[model samples]
Target: MPQAEVDTPLDNAAVEARRAAARAVQTAFRNSGVHAMLEVATTRAAPAVSVTIPLGGTSGSPFLGGTGLPLPDGAGPLQQLLEHHDIHAQVTVIELGPDPALLVALTTGDDALRLAALVIERRSDAHDAALRLSGVFADLGITEDHIYVADGAVQVGDINVQDAITLYDVLTGQRNDAAELDLGDRWDPRTWRDVEKLAELMGPVVSKAAGEPLDCIPHPACRTCISSRPHRITLGSASPQQVLLLADAISSANSSSTSGVSPPTG
Candidate 1:
């Protein structure tokens, strides 16, 4: 005989509550301009949503204030939205300055890169709420080999905490080697904002290397962007010697295409 279905009053109420929460989150996404990304992410069973909204220009932080429960700084509203409604899906937020190309990459890339990108974004010191966010991918069982940087000419495969640190060392070491490294002609057409965007894209790799617990601090070059660490390091603030080193590191990354190195995996 087939098993009889059981419907408890509590179960029914819980289901209704979850549906309601999903609707509320959806509404927020639509109104906040995050709807497009949400729709794309939701199409799959395990979705990785990546979107870039202007800083200090949105109604509330992507993930606004939640019940007394804590939230990471810059964490999108998706986390609380999911937990509030008892939704069991995995949702991670990545913060990047306005760059249409990044949004495109996030949406089109494979799951591993998407996940790595999120890990990279989460490093920004802008989000100061909790240490609760680190290891999110690992906790979810996403291994290091799964994460990588796929931009042209720059391929950092299997980017994990240690690999991120190594990248940071490589750049910083290069910075120290030359004080006034040229960014090359390719970078001539770009503005400082564009340079900042490149820093943001690469910030995860460097920040993860330097910050304890694998978090990232914004490059000193991006001093104007909304950030929690005002006293953070920047090429401007770096000592004469340090300034040269910082420049060389950035120049190397900017100039090299298809020449990124990945640390040896155990």
Candidate 2:
């Protein structure tokens, strides 16, 4: 018959129906967790955290409720879904959009997400690698059976619980002023090697104390201790290639969260 209304004209009633449908969909996405994650993932180079199709998340996807969320094989969810899954993890609070407008927008747009970045600041251990080592020693449990000096490296003869603790404090700055130390301007191989070496030296002490091997997060301290640096890793996706950041590298890498003019944040 007559191709049934392929080019139907819109009347006043039709226009109202269109508006209502559009409004409903918008309302569903507004202030939703999926929307919030989408907003943040757009800021980052990665969007897998927000989407389900290989790398595409819908604003109304039920997976956000921890029902059918697809966590990649190796890469886990990027801190945004931690609370949704009832997972307790350390989180770094972040503004949703550009400041001034950032806070206002998140507050008005998606108060449910609350906007934070939960990064891996710690490994799987009783406490943070350094903190655990430091605490064990401070508790007065370990002792050093002997001391060995080779190539200017101090080696414990037989680390008891207390001495292991001492080493962690000495290296990780648990008992020392670590925050004052710097990580240098650039993280060259030499710097990384030095940091690695220091961590290796310090790792054993703490391990003996805690009775397990451990490495602390933001190991920039390991570099400072070994290389005697004074420059911290200025991170942030928009941070300068080499900025003398007053804050930690984790803060610097959030280039998307930066104010202005800075480039290459995280």
Per-model lDDT: 0.32, 0.30
Q: Say which candidate scores most in lDDT.
A: 1
User: What would the per-residue lDDT of candidate 2 be over residues 1-266, giving only the tens digit for each residue?
Assistant: 66663433445654454344334323233312233222222221222122111223343232232333333332344344544644433333233333211011221112222222121221112112222222333344332233222222222233422233333443343434222223243333344444434444554433332333333212343444635532122111111111112112223222322343332311
Which regions of candidate 1 are displaced past 4 Å? 1-26, 30-36, 41-55, 66-71, 74-81, 98-266
TM-score of each: 0.20, 0.21
What value does the lDDT take at residue 113 in candidate 2?
28
Clashes of each: 11, 30
Off by over 4 Å in 2: 1-37, 40-197, 215-266
All candidates: CA RMSD (Å): 18.7, 19.7
lDDT of 1: 0.32
